[model samples]
Target chain A: MAASSRRDGGAAGRAKAERSAWVLLTPMCLLMAVAFILPVGLFLLYSFYRFRGGRLEETFTLETYWRFMTDELYLITIYDTLQLAVLATLLCLVISYPLAYAMWRMRSPGLQKLIAFIVFAPVLVSVVVRSYGWTVVLADQGPVNFILTRLGLTSGPVSLVYNMTGTVISLAHVFLPFVVFPILASMLRLDPTLREAAEDLGASWWKTFRSITLPLTLPGVVAGAQICFTLSLGSFVTPAILGGGRVLVLPIQIYTATSDINWPVAAVGGLCLLVMAFIAVVAFGRLSQYSEAV
Target chain B: MAARIARAGRLPAWRHLALGIFTVAAVVFILAPLVIVILTSFSAQSYAIFPPEGYSLRWYANLAAQTTFYVAALRSLILALVATAASLVIGTMTAYALVRYRPRGHSALKAIFLSPVVLPKMVLGVAVFMLVIKIGFYGSSWNLVLTHTLICVPFVIAIVAASLANFDWSLQEAALDLGSKPLPTFLKVILPQISVSVFISGLLAFVTSFDQVETTMFLMRPGESTLPIEMFLYLQRWQDPTIAALSSVLIVFAIFLLVMTSLVLGRRKITTLQTSAEPQP
Candidate 1:
């Protein structure tokens, strides 16, 4: 009886220790729960709230959702947001691919290291600084316009700053590193034997690249695009600064709405951005599967 | 082979020259604007110009004259430090739990934990703003700390978990069989192995938390803003060389951080090349 009692005591002690472990985890878990989960969940709920008379009505109505569907302005904003994100993401990928490839193909390790630093150094700097820099570069009197006009490319320096072109160019610059690194990682991870085999089969350099290298790195391309698209969709700072009051992405629209005390519309807009990002993630996951199959 | 070598030598003559030119152009695209900002910081005039009429240190001097900038910079520094320390402790603990303990439904819980990465920060800002207003914690520094904590936790978890996943757990078993206490076992055994990851993630969190703009924009009251929010708002009303001056200061600060971290990290390379530095479990 004493033996059984002692065994039962040990079991209880183990259970108590496990409970203590969970108890120790409580603060952080609570921090995440309260600050992250609750706020975002509440925001999702707030999208259903009714905005009336320049005030927020905390209700369960789907009026905001219905309004978003019926409203042309909202639809247009959504369309513009999608178009901007897609174009920016594509532009980033196109530039990053060659840059990453060049970095990958370099025989000299020192050069590779240098290129990597140059690619990623801007990320450590503030986005605001980079955006401000682009504003100067793409400005009417900036070096770019000066060169364009000097080359007789145009009759005058074109209106580049405070426009969509500037925003897209700046954003592409902003997200370039995110795309480049992932592709480089995949390129480095590429099995050398396959490339060697392609060479062994007497395939030319271009053919080897097309058949062996490109397919292997498609996953990286998809991964990079996913990051760029999702990030661009939610970007607030660049569009606000470089957009110069002309470009209107969802994040800016949401910001404006929230400032106006239009909680429902802001929430709905954020929801759309969130949904668009989610779809991109899902779509990329699917595309990666197809790439793997090939 | 000689023919191929000849072709390779000649190939560098034109095509590779073009390639090198393109690469240099890309680098210029990345670097020139930053160079302009740094150069403009030394301008004699208030307005931006590529070739400054003359050079002066006045803007940097002017930045020193702003008391508000100093206070805001200090506050942001302290706040980011607090958040970094807070997230490091919690994040390491949580990552350990997720890794060591085979708790049920860990993956789903992890996904939930990391959802902040995907959830738009503006949405987060507005939501937290409304929630705080309702909960009566609207203007508190804790709100900022909490929000930044949420923002930074995923990064910490990702880095630490990646490191811990690579760790050989048999070492833990060896420590335990030798009769070490769990707490001591963790500190003396586990920490040194993953210290690199912890420090890197902590560095990243500090920078990210310190650099927040849009989220902190609404969170702070007008006079009581953080540094980045202060600068962001200041930029709206002004386009003077003051910002260029401030940016140059920020550039110096970033350089200081890089130097400090390099000293701290020692042999570990700063570039985040491999997400996991060590081999995976």
Candidate 2:
């Protein structure tokens, strides 16, 4: 009986220890609740508020949703937003494919490291600085246009900034590292045996790439594209700086609404951006599944 | 067969040249604006002219002479430090609980913690600003610090959790069995192994907090700004050589960061530095 009582005491001690462990976890749980979960929750709720006469009504309504659905201006913002994200992702993919391929092909780890470093170095610098740098490069008298004019590629320096071209180019450049790493990860995971088998079967290099390499690495490409799209969708600083006020993406719209103190409109714009980003995430998930299943 | 061989040989050569040029041009393109800013800083006159009429360092001297930038710099640094400390505490605790406590709903908890990674900072800024105003907690440095910590926690949790995953739990078990207190066991055994991740995440947290502009923009009471905000305001007001001088300083700051990164990560694998901290399984 005494031995059985001691055994019960042992179980009780174990339970007590775990209870203390739960106690230790309290700070973290509290923080996430207050800081992360609460802010986002409170933030999202403003979307349902009415902003009549520049004053936000505390009462909840779906009028903002209706406005978002019915308003042509909001619809145009959505269209422009998707177009920007898609173009940015496509450009990033085109740039990253060769870059990642070269990194993967090199046998020397040292060379790989150096190339990777160069690609990622810009991320350490401020995005504002990088964007500012592009404004100079894309300016009419900037080095890019200067070189083009001297080389007779253009009659004069064409307008780059305050338009879609500069925005896409810089956005792609800014996101190049994000895209490259995912694709490179996928490429590195490719089985060398498959390529060798293709070559042995009398397939040419291009044929091997098309049949074996491309399809195998398609998952990574999709993932990289997904990241680029979502990031570009939420990107505010780059478009603001390079777009020179011509670009009217959702983030900028949200910012303007906030500045104008129209919480309902800003909230609605933010929700729309959030929804688009959510869609991109969902689409990316589907693409990954399809790629893997294929 | 001869035609096929010729086509194959020529194609690789062309592709190689094309790829090489593309690579070089892209790097140059990425670095060009920064280079131009450096050059413009040395201009004798007060305009953004490339290949300046003559070279001088007057703007840089003027940059050194600005007091507001100094204050803003200090504020940014302090705010980042406070936020980093806050995140490390919360993230470390959360990572421990999520990993070690055998908790139900771990995944949901993690998703909540990490949601800000995809959350637009501008939206959060607007929302928080409104909420704070609504709650009558408007325009305090505490508000900025708290909001910034929320954004910064996900990065810390990610890195620290990964490092913890790599840690040998048996050692932790051994310590616990040998009658070490849980906190001390974590401190003496687990933390040392995961210190590298903690340090990296801390640096990242510092940088993210310091470099924030858009989120902090609305939060800044007029004339009280972070360095990036200050630089942004200065840029908006004037595009003169003085701004170039300030940018050159920022370029130096970038170089300083690079050197610091190498010193910290030189012994570590290149792949680890390039990769974002892996999500904890």
- For lDDT, the strongest prediction is 1
Residue-level lDDT of model 2, residues B1-281, one tens digit each, is 67546644545576667767877766686677778878877889776544468998899889889999999989998999999999888888888776665356666877767777777788778877877777888778887988789778888888776666656677876787799997899899988888767877887788789888778888889999998888777766776777777767777887787778768677676556534622311
Q: Which stretches of candidate 1 lie over 4 Å from their true place?
A: A1-25, B1-15, B261-272, B276-281
Identify the CAPRI category of the predicted complex in candidate 1. Answer: acceptable
lDDT by residue for model 1 over B183-256, one digit each (tens)? 99999999999987888788878877888876787889879988877777777788777888887778778777
Q: Taking the tens digit of each residue's C-alpha lDDT, what string does model 2 give over A221-271? A: 988888788879988888888888778899999888888878888888887
For candidate 1, give fnat to 2 decimals. 0.40
- The total number of steric clashes, by the backbone 3 Å criterion, in model 1 comes to 0
lDDT against the true structure, each candidate:
0.80, 0.78
The Cα error of candidate 1 at residue A25, in Å, is 4.3
Clashing pairs in 1: none
The per-model DockQ list reads 0.42, 0.43
lDDT of 1 at B122: 85
Q: Identify the candidate with maximal TM-score.
A: 1
Interface C-alpha RMSD after superposing true interface residues, each candidate, one decimal: 5.1, 4.4
